[model samples]
Structure formats: structure tokens, C-alpha cells
Target chain A: MAGKDDDVKVLGVVVSPFAIRVRIALNIKGVSYEYVEEDIFNKSELLLTSNPVHKKVPVLIHGGKPISESLVIVQYVDEVWAAAPSVLPADPYDRAVARFWAAYVDNNVSTVLYTVLAMAMSPKLFDEQLLMFPGMAGVLFAATEEERAAKAEETLAALAQLEKAFAECAGGKAFFGGDSIGYVDLALGSNLHWFEALRRLFGVALLDAGKTPLLAAWAKRFVEAEAAKGVVPDAGVAVELGKKLQARAAAASTAA
Target chain B: MAGKDDDVKVLGVVVSPFAIRVRIALNIKGVSYEYVEEDIFNKSELLLTSNPVHKKVPVLIHGGKPISESLVIVQYVDEVWAAAPSVLPADPYDRAVARFWAAYVDNNVSTVLYTVLAMAMSPKLFDEQLLMFPGMAGVLFAATEEERAAKAEETLAALAQLEKAFAECAGGKAFFGGDSIGYVDLALGSNLHWFEALRRLFGVALLDAGKTPLLAAWAKRFVEAEAAKGVVPDAGVAVELGKKLQARAAAASTAA
Candidate 1:
């Protein structure tokens, strides 16, 4: 049997915001674990077996038992490492609010932003297989520049809503969890690099300082947190990765 | 300020599986609350204010504070009413597994199943405004019988995966929570009536006795539970509602 320390393993890709979420939570909880980088294009057998349903990365294998999904993994980490600082709020209502926003981040904000990023980077990636989320394609992806611009507008609207949520949740605090980073913080914060990458490379401003001042300020503070040190990737690195992936996708399309 | 019992109120529509999930949880916890059935077509001011983000059904209001989303509400109910028979598994690993399955139910099984039902009943609902889920249109909805059959096949495949999960989670127990209804049970169980309605009216067998025996059997046991008595609406009534909505949709389309 593996020891307590060695038993914890995270199967993830460094570039993925979902994978980074698990790392951030583990870092905050002060839990050390082995990180196995998966080739997302050609997934590892371990990852495939670990998450047969989704076959996605960021599977936290604890005591030989695999737990998939970033949010679920974060909560699992918080629960198992009970001694560490809590990821979710101690209060039930507050926890629910956190859960709600985290879900909003996933369903409304992150998916739209990421889909738009994918569209911007590699239009070829919009093919059937790459668009894993079926229903969101219409609302998210665009064929023409006009439609893409409209989608970007929708992204801004979502960010504006998140800005409001942050105001309510933060209640005049540094982080969404007040002094320290909490569930909602990690949920949106994990994608900070992607937001930066979008703005720098594509001129797509998701977290605008002028529009969503609180969230914009929150993003700056979030990246500087001790737990965020190595977990959150550089915006430059993200842009490079996006370019590499887009080239590969383009090549694949040409070959086909 | 409202008293303990009176403070709790649910803003929901009767036919929505999502709303039914909240009622089931509250019922299981033995918490008393006033149920406000919202007209989904013309959402009330309270419903709009309560759930401005989603503007959907199943908002749990406790002491003037509102929490939206069915799964989030179930967890909130479990946390706040900690003394009551736990809705989620006591073990964190078990809890994570349950959460994963519940998410799968929402993403994979329920959405596909429900969307197909909507397509079958009201084809006109496929219009831009009603097709709220844009990308999913390609994979989920079908204008032709052949395409719809393929989508149904996909739903069945998803169910097969859930069947495997049930075997792992149940481990010869009656419920997903092991001898009692837990989070996953409620998550999937809320759609029992709809599943039945689909099967009876459209011959869309989602939870077939032959294919997924365990889940089919589990559905029976789920509806029989005391918590499911009033919460799980009648399959016949669901069929009637589907017919009424279909007629209305057809009329609107013709009029347009």
C-alpha cells in the first residue's frame, strides 16, 4: 500500500485551467502530491481508466481511488485535508452561494470565454470532435467575425454579472472568500492566465479593469497569492501553447 | 424575520425535474416550506429577483436568502439541516463519487433525455429563442426520425455508463446512498416521471428494464420512497402537459 503522501496523485495537463484548479486547491491545503502530465491529444492509459466517463484530465487519485472533475476534486481535497484552510465556506448558505458562482463560472463564463478563445486561436478546432459541449456551440462559437464579436459581447455581459456577484460575495474584501482564496476564487481564478492571454494576443478583454474593476483587481491579487505561485501558468506560455495547438489542428485539417 | 419553518420557501414550476429535486430533498429532510409554483413562460417578479442569473425554476428561499440550482440547493439543504438523515454520503470519497454521477446525470443523461422529449412533443420549440442551448442542437435535437433515433442511442449509451456506476456505488445496496436515497438518487430520480412520460407517449425508453435493470429497478424503489410521494409527479400528468405544450407551440409557429 502506498503511504499517505505518495498515494495522492494528480493526472493533469499544465495548460488546462480545470487541472490548475485542483493544483491551486491542493497548494492552498498544503497537500503534496505527484503530478503526472497527460498528453491531452493522446491521453494516458491511467487517465483513460481513471476517468472512463469523461476521459478528461485533472483526475485526483487518492489511495488508488480516482476522483474526476476539478470542482469535485477541490472539495475532496478540502474535506480529506480537514486541518488545512477550507476551500468552501463553513456556513451552509455561504457554501451554496460559492457553489452557485463556481457553477456560473463553469457554465456561463469559463465555457464561453474558453470556446471563444478556441475559436479565435483555431477555427479548425470547431469541428465535431473538438466541440465536446454540444448545446453551447450556437451561443458560444461563431463562423463570421460579426458573430464572434457578438459572442465576445456575451462574454463581457457574463463578466459584468460576475462583477456584480463578486461585489455581493466579497462584501468589501480582498478575495471572494474575504481575506483568503475560497471556492469561487479558485473557480474563476484558475482561468486568470487564459483571460490575460486572450487580452494580450487577441485583444479580447474578458476581465476589464474599467468595466469589472473589483474582479479585475481580484484577478491581480489572485495571481499573486502564495498558493498561485507555480500553479497558474504565464499568459505568454498560454499564448504559445494555444498557437502550437492551433497549428497542429490546422495541419490535421489539411491532411484530412 | 420569519420563523424556522415559515422562513423556507421554494420558487419552482411543478413539471420541471430540477424543481422536483429541491422538493424531494426538503421532503427527505422533513423540512416544511411553502411551494410557489412559477409560470415558467411568464416568470414572477420574486422568481426573477431570486434567480436573476439563470432565471430558472427551483430557487430555495430561506430567511429571505435565495439559493438557485437544484443540485446546489440539495447540498445546501443537507448542510443546513445537518441533523436530518444525511442526503450526501458521510465519507468524502463516497460524496465525491455521488457528486460526479449527479453531474453526469445532468450533463449526459437528463439533458439529452429531456431535450429529446421536448423535440418529440414540440418541434417548433427548435426555433432560435426556445433552443436556449445552441451547440447542443447538433448532438441532441433532431428534425428527422433517423437523427432522433441516433440521439436516443446516445442517451442509452450514457445510461449504460450510469448502470456501471450504479453497480460500483450500490454494491448490492438498495439506493445510491446505500439502503437510502442520496444525492445521486435524487439527482436522477427527479426525472423518473419524465422518463416514464417519454416512454409511454413517444416510445423513447430511457431507463429500459432490459437494458439498465438496476437503474430501472432503482427508479421503482425511488418513486416508492416517502420523500418521493408528492415530489415525483405522475407520469400521466407529464404526458398531458407535453401534449398541451406541443399544441401551444404548434399554434404559435403557425401563427408566426
Candidate 2:
């Protein structure tokens, strides 16, 4: 239960990995908050007012003040709830390494997912509107299955890099932060369901055991972790959603 | 005056704003270190060894441990120094706000500069290679003066958003972190010279007094700050460099 003064609310969408990251961080910290699922298309006034700059979800409204961006929110959670079980590592160097990997995951791995997911989630917008925004078009648009496959290869390459990063950061431990689920784990793990969904949709094995053995094992442990309970979506649901969106996009394209 | 155990070295290029960020942060903290300017075209083994993943600079090597990425290095500086003159805000919410804006500058603002700069700095790479990287192409490849002008308008708009952010964060103070320079200041201020060069090269006033008055004033003050003495470059040198690069690119195109 949230206290009167320490009220926390999360403006998010169920399928968003970014939103899921905030939930996982809050869940790990054991900080209770009200979750308000947003219609990303027709965003709420609160979401708009809260995150005016980005106007996107996973906004953590703590004590009436809104903090947008999932990574920023997770760090905010770590700082505000400064007790045991810290999300980031305690040492300065370790902390920097965690931040580096977290960012790398966002820039390299997450962008690929967003490209495909953006198409799946908002096919009409992907087809019609994204053309206007060239920068976003590069990020969110994949014209063909060929392009998607190429992007998938990039994702695999990124995962391989993360595999080495995990070996270095984890150092024969369970997770990137070592012995416990930490910032890097949360950053990459939140997208595990989507990674699975991508595999189901396009036959792209992002976390292939053959390629990234450590990361593949880490993924399994991460999804099974107590903090991930109810926070991470089931892969099947994500796949079904992807299929539905794909069908809609095909119909829209045909009409156009 | 560096001690044996606490040796610090920065592998960077003079023109890089990202590298300059590390210098500014280190200079402010009064940390004495070696500056190894890397030839980005023919990157040294040391630079490659230090930051094998990205292999780009502003790689801060502390006591033989290497940390890549400018923002990450700055944070590491703050954490390790742990003095009164902190780069990041001590308050959790304020820190979150600062980090959000810093990232906003990197994602929204620095990107435009990088696009223009990449073309100016590496004309051969731009002409020969960048076509294959479509994602980078959208960000870096602007064929005409028209596209560059459009990007300039986008930069001006970003500056306007940042002007409001400064008002909120500074609350009538000198810098984004308050009276003293902080994280957001270093993040954005590091690019002041490059911004000037962009203006000189394209006749686009990014920090137009008419549009973003507060930011224009902030930029002036930031450049004059004591910590920025030798860290920030002279706009004349950057402008000259841009001109030279432009000429070479034009000559290369004509010959082709």
C-alpha cells in the first residue's frame, strides 16, 4: 500500500518493455505503486502533461512529480528507495560498467526490437507517418522481411557483445551485476518476452544458445527470478499480439 | 602531479565534444591526468585495446582500468572525486531530472551535431561507406543544403525545449544544476564550440537570442567559466576545420 505522502503511480502500457523495466525495478525494490495502463495511441492527459517532451509511457509519478524514461525511472527508483538490494552496483567502477552496459543494451539491442515492435504495434503509423521523421524511420522502419532479418542479425551481434560483457561484469556469477539481478539485467531482461515473440514471429533466435551460451542461460534465470513475476509478459500473448498487428498492417497496406 | 596508484589517462580527439566533456569534468575536479590525442582515422592500439567494443574515444583510463563513453566517464569522475564540487546533483529527483536532460541533449541535440560533424570530419567515409549503414544514413547523410537547414531548425527547436528545461532546473540560477555548473551543463555546454562552428558553416544561429534567449546567455556564461579555460575549443578553429573538410569533400566529388 502506498502512503499518503509517498504516493507512486506508473503511467505505462502492458506490452512496452520500457514500462516493464520500471515495473521490474519497483518490484525488486518492493516499492508498491499504482499501475495505470495507458492507451499509447490516445494517451491520457496525465501521460501528456507528465512527459511533455517525449509524450511516451513508463512515466513514474512519485509524490506528484513525474519522471519520464524507463532507465531514468529505474535509477530514480534505486536512488529514492536507498535500502538493501540496490539495483546498481555499489562500487563506482562497477556502477559505471552497469550504466555502460545498460546504455549499450538500449542503443544497440533495444533499438532493433523497437524497429520491429513499432511496426507491429502501430502499422498504420509505421506505414504512413514514420516517413516524415527520417531519423525515426531509420530506427522504427523495416521495409521488408529481408530488412528485418538483417536487423535480427545485428541484434544477434549485439547479444554476442553482451555475452562477453556479461562474462566480464558477472565474473562467473548469475547476472550482470553478479549474484543478483541488477541494472543491466533489468535493462536487457525486460525485453526477453519480446525477444521470444520476435523468434515466434520471424524465426530469429536472438538469444541462441549456440551463439550466446552465457546470455541464453542468463535469460532463463532472469525470467524465472522472483522480481520478474507478473512483470514480464508471456511470450505467447506477445506473439499473438504481433500476429494480429501484422494482419492489420497487411490489410492496411492492401487498402492503400 | 598524479600519484602512482591513481594514474589517469584520457584517449581522445581535440575536436570531439564527447571527449571535451571528460576534460571539463576532470578539470573541474582538479584531477591531473595525461591526454593522449588519438588519430581517429588510424586509431592506435591503445585506444582499440581500451575501448574494443565501440573503439571510439573519450576513453578514461584510471589506474589501468578503461572506461569508455563521455557521460559515463564524467559520472565516474564525480563518483571517484566525491568532493563538494560534484558534477551531478546530490538530490535524487534533481539528479534524475539532470540525467534526463543530459540524455535528451545526447539523443536529440548532440545527434544533429554528430550528423553534420561526421560529414565534415570524415568526408571520404561519408562518401564511400555510410551508404551501407542505413540507420546511420538517416542521421548522418544529408545530401543538400536544404536538409542541413531543416536539421538546423530542428536543433533550434531542441534548444527552445532546453531553454524551458534550464528555467525549471536552474530556477533563475546561472547553470542547469544551479549557481554552479553540473551534469546537464557539462553535457550541453561541451558542444558550444561545435554549435558555433555549425552556425559559421551554415549561417544557422542555433543559439539565437531571439528564440532561446536564456540558452544564448547560458552558452556565453558557460564558455567564460573558469573550469572551461582550455577544455573548450575556440570557435574559429572549429569553423576553419569545417571549411577545410567541406572543400576536400567538394574536390573529391568533382574528381569523381
Which pairs of residues have clashing backbones in candidate 1? A134-B135, A134-B136, A135-B135, A135-B136, A137-B135, A138-B135
**Per-residue lDDT of B1-256 in model 1, one digit per residue for the tens?**
1245568999987777888889989898889999999876677999989998877778999999999998999999998888888999989899999999999888766552244334443454433323232222222334456755766776788788888989999999999888888999988888777777767766788888999999999989999999889878888877876666555544555654
Q: Candidate 2 docking category?
A: acceptable
Candidate 2, residue B149: Cα displacement in angstroms equals 2.5
What TM-score do all the candidates reach, one by one? 0.88, 0.88
* Candidates' C-alpha lDDT: 0.77, 0.77
Fill in the DockQ of model 2.
0.47
The recovered share of true contacts, given per candidate in order, is: 0.74, 0.67
TM-score of chain A of 1: 0.85
DockQ of each: 0.53, 0.47
Name model 1 segments beyond 4 Å from true: A1-4, A112-141, A244-256, B1-3, B112-141, B244-256
Error of 2 at A77 (Å): 0.7
Instruction: Report the poorest 10 consecutive residues by lDDT, candidate 2 chain B.
Output: B131-140
